[model samples]
Target: MASKYRRGFDITRDSLRVFTREPSLILLPVLSLLAVGSAFAVLTAIVFQQGLVESLVTNDLYQYGALFCAIAISSSVATFFNAAVVHCAAQLFDGNPTSVRDGLAAAWRARRQIAVWAVVAATLGTVLYILDEKFGVVGSLTRAVFNLAWALLTFFIVPVIVLDERRSLRRQLRRSGSLFRDTWGESVSATLGVSFVFLLVALPGVALGAVGFFVLDGILATGALVSGGVIIVAAIVGSQTASAIVRTALYRYATTGEGVGPFENRDPDTVFPES
Candidate 1:
């Protein structure tokens, strides 16, 4: 059994490993671009929803409720696609020998599970948003920590659903969650660490977008538009690459005994049942 508490690995180190081991993982970068683009579209929809709700909810309470519901549905769909992309990237980077079409196909195959997970994640976020608005909970450190912990804890769920074809939804989630629990610190460190680097690389683009906005007097200037667009694309690509790395790490740990604990104890016979 995987000891679950294995250490000495993280996202940054894992990413470094991938880059060094297989620099030809071009699909990761492409997946990142696609994921980020989809995210941008989803964000735009949410923003538009708030504006629409404000404009249309002057007298009708039901209209406001309906708008919010629509936004939630749209957000969930975007999240499902994003999760799918992450799974695809992970499989590709892990030497799964798949294409973008394979990634999409994987998502389609696991659509139900992905959709369920999306709704759950979005509902959590929405609840936090509600609390922030209704009870002035925005500054609560506990809330912040809760959100952070939840995000990291469930990081492996989608990838598990996408990559583990032999298992059903319940088993896949349970197994992934268990694997993650055993490797919690490592997972968090790697995920957050890589995300930080991505943010650092993206910061300059954000600054340029800000300059564009100001230079254009709050209107979208050419520079701002270009900068923002580039930043978004970079974010997407980075995300996809990161997903591939995480998937590789988990799958390896699960099947090949790459990490600490249960990973090492994996039955070689079970690891490659077909071989």
Candidate 2:
């Protein structure tokens, strides 16, 4: 357990280093946010025009359908950019220079696979949402468990899709699950570390925002709020970039029996124990 935590910290630290070296990586998450937001806006507009919004509000079935579509579209956009980020991270791992343009091109090339995976993800999300909405407490518990399982199973799907575009979506998902099972169960620890780092990064901004709301007034308060918002956005972008880098490194190590970044020179057995 201690070793797992140590490995998680190392992964997070190395991922941060990669992000520092290539600051442009942050743009991937930023663009992903913008793309998803735009898609949601468009979807909302279309749904409203078609009177689906009213139906969604009044009818459970319509609501679920709308929710599923929204989740699917947003998730798909995110998956596209995540794939691009993974592509760029892979290049960095290989000691090759890659631009955001190159990464975007790679993602575009694998658009079909991304689309299919997005549908799968969306379906899972919708089912979970429906479970929570229909079954009350029991459904909510089931949804939570399934959500975590889904996350674990598909953790490496983006890297697999980016690296091996020829594989079918089902195969890619299965491969991701298999690779994760073969790994040293570091996902929970790594996630906790990343979340802790994000909290640290966002703390100042949150403090400022709270101060602005409670103590500051007028222009000073507005300035503080704006600054806080910017800082929070930066923190989110940084966290996302680091996560992608770490995930890509993990996938590489899992598949090639080699490591990049801080993982280099580390024993594979130590990283992924045979227990």
The best candidate in terms of lDDT = 2
**TM-score on alpha carbons, each prediction:** 0.64, 0.86
- Global lDDT of each candidate: 0.56, 0.80
* TM-score attained by model 1: 0.64
Candidate 2 has an lDDT of 0.80
lDDT of 1 by residue, 71-136 (tens): 456545544554555554455454565555655676677777766665666566656655555566
Model 2 poorest ten-residue lDDT run: 266-275
Instruction: Please give, for residues 1-275, the per-residue lDDT of candidate 2 as tens digits.
Output: 66655565666777877756677777889998888878888887888788786787899888878878887888788889988988988888888888889899999998988888888888888888888988999999999999888888888888999996447977888889988888735554455667677878799999999999999999999999989988998888777777777778778888887878656656544554534
